[model samples]
Target: MPLLHIENLTHSFGATRALVGIDLKVERGEIVALMGANGAGKSTLVKILSGVLTADGGTIALKERPFAPKTPHEAAGAGIATVHQSTDIVGVPGLTVADALLLHRIAEHRTSLFVSRSGLRREAKALIDAAGFSLPLDRDFGELAAAERQLVAIARALADKADLLILDEPTASLSSEESQRLFDILRRLRAQGIAVLYISHRTADLQAIADRALVMRGGRIVASFSRPIDFSSAIQSMIGRRLDAVRPDARPVGNPVLEIRNGQLAATSVPFDLTVKQGEVVAITGPIGAGKSRLLSAIFGVGRFACGEMFLDGRPYRPRSPAEAIAAGVSMAAEDRHRSSLMPAGWPGHSLAATISLPHLTKWYRKGFLFGNRERREANRAISRFGIKASDPLASVWSLSGGNQQKAVIARWEAEPSRLLLLDEPFQGVDVGARREIVEAIRVRTDRATLIATSDPEEAYEVADRILTIDRHALLPTAADPTTNLAITGT
Candidate 1:
């Protein structure tokens, strides 16, 4: 019998069938990759498995025993652990790495036996060591970097006696090296006969770790690829269509719109020079701390360079704040949408129309009174232009899927004309079809210069006419040929 077996699992929300007749098996000592697009029912299925939802109809067996958990704690008790895309340690670093790792244990034993701080540290240290994770047990959780923060979460999950580990977008924020470290840990877990269900959109992550690949589309398992997987085929199955035979639409590059001379992103970086022409899309690719977002933020006036000069449209541009940047015809979409781009439904100005019209409210006001009709009109226009799948402009932006939400955010910036458009990891959690739509939307208008910051070279290839890398917080020279990078080389 398999370690985990599911037969005809099905679920629905309202009239929408989020999951339909799903069948799968996970064996011990293996890592299985789950591939799907956003809104393809992956999140719904995961929620059911994690005990956050009950399936409408299905059967799941753990070691041949019927299994149904009613809560996350019950799921944990059943030896199933889920680590979400974001590294979340509850009541943690707010509390030392050790405290975060052992919060539940500490809470359970604190009243029975008083343990000193040093004693708690030692216990946590031993647990992480046993799990083969190298972490500073005494350090504050907040001090850890993004990769380290995720590792701490994984270590804690594994130490809690997880038999089957489910990781969602585990390497979303990790560098290549950091991702390798995570892969190593996962390999060790497989050697110890643990079952792992890994979900990711990254080709690199799947190529590196997945022992088997399962593709899901339309709430069903459409395809599966075994070792020596045909990745091209897997991607085609996941997206359910062949990628375009040619580039979407490549426009001619125009005169220089952005110029940076002898600039340093941080005090510890070397000087660099760069230029972006109007009607061109340039992408900056680098690791997490390599200052990809920093470069975009610098241009948007939310971040800075140690010493550098910038010129927009051949005029010196030095924005002191985002308002100044906006006034100068510059707009930017940040990396994390939840914390930055989006607001909950109940909050004022959270609707699709309001979100798109937020920064341009001054233009919507006449005699000190704003017009909702114009806002809704513009919002509907953006939805149509960007191919957003929202039926109502007045609906909350949160009602959209991850991809649509992202489109809405980018639409917010694109609504008003701008000289330079900045996008940071615009395709972070989106899938192929949505990614194509976003690229198409960004390319349709050639009136402005577009600069994108991302860690994925493939994304740069898909979106940018030119690709540059940064190291040590310093902008690197762009290659004479855009396809010089190995990632850009066609296999």
Candidate 2:
């Protein structure tokens, strides 16, 4: 019998049906890939399987026995472990690697509080080594790089002896080399009869790791495939359309809009120079920790630049804060939308009306009291322009899918005229269809000079008129083909 079986699984959130009559099965030693666009019910299904959410109607059988877990701890005890996209669930930031690995064991000792620190370290080392990772056991888990944290989370799952593992966007923060190491580990786990349910937007990862593929759209299972999967068809199933490359035609460059010289992110970093022209899109591509994000932060005035001279339209421009930058005709779409951008509790209109005053969609104060008709009108226009899927314009932004939320945040900058636009990792959790829409929107607006930061070469090729790389704080233009020349400053 298969290791896991589900029949007629259905779930809903208020009026929105997240999952509808989903049926699936996974045998031991099999790796299944789940593909879906944002809000396609992938997160809902995973939550039900991980005990984070209770399915309204469904029958699940594990090892030929009925199984239903009411809590995450219950799910873990039932031999089902989940590693979500964010590593926060692994453990608190202050905890050591050993503590993170054996957190459950530590929590289990309710009566006798005395725990053996030496034993925890030894056990944690064994788990890390078994997972083929050499992470420092005594180091604080939060201080490590994103890829290292990902490995520790996987190691923790293995330590739990979970028979069925669910991984959501596991490699989103990992480097290509680290991603390959993880694929190797997953293969070893599969050889040992561990069933893996993998979720990701990266086609390369799906091809490398998954044995079978399942496509979900509009809260339903639309398609499934065996080995040697047809990825194009799978993507089509997810988005309900033929996915096309989002390459934008290069527009005629105008006079320089912004110029920087002798700029250093920090006193110890290398100095660099760059120039951006109106109607031009320049992409900066580099590996993590290579200063891609640091550059954006400095330019957006969130971080200090050690020494630099900046000019906006041939005038001196140095902003001490984001507000100052905004006043000077500059706008930024931050990297981490959940933390650095967006108010989840706010309505969709509040998010899109942030940078510009869409008078029709913005509420003009009446007798020192606020109204929302204009805000609603502005949000609806943005929603229609970006094809954001939502029941109404007044819906809380937190209710939308990851891709749609990203769209709303990005669309906010387009509400007003800006001389320079900055976008960092704009397509992090977005699918092909949404990525195309976002790129097209940015391309169509030829009045502003835009700077994009990404680690993916394909994304750089699709949207960037010129590609640059950051290394040791130095920004240098890459050859026409970014894939062949990945090195930036050779740090």
Best by lDDT: 1
* Cα error of candidate 2 at position 160, Å: 2.1
Per-residue lDDT over 1-491 for candidate 2, one digit per residue giving the tens place of the 0 to 100 score: 99999999999998899999999999999999999999899988988988989999989998888888889889888889999866756776799988888786768763235657887788788888888777889999767665577788887777677899999888776767778888998998899999999998888999999999999998999999988999999999889988876455645889898898888887888788888889988888888778887787788788878998988989998888888888888888876676556654554434444322322122245465556665667678888899887777767676677788888888777666789999988888787778888888888877889999888878877787778888777786555544333222211
Clashes of each: 0, 4
- Native-vs-model 2 lDDT? 0.80
Residues 230-253 of candidate 1 have per-residue lDDT tens digits of 878988998888876244345578
Off by over 4 Å in 1: 88-99, 103-148, 244-250, 344-346, 349-351, 365-379, 389-399, 478-491
* Candidate 2: residue pairs that collide: 361-374, 361-375, 361-378, 362-374
- Candidate maximizing TM-score: 1
lDDT at 157, model 1 = 76
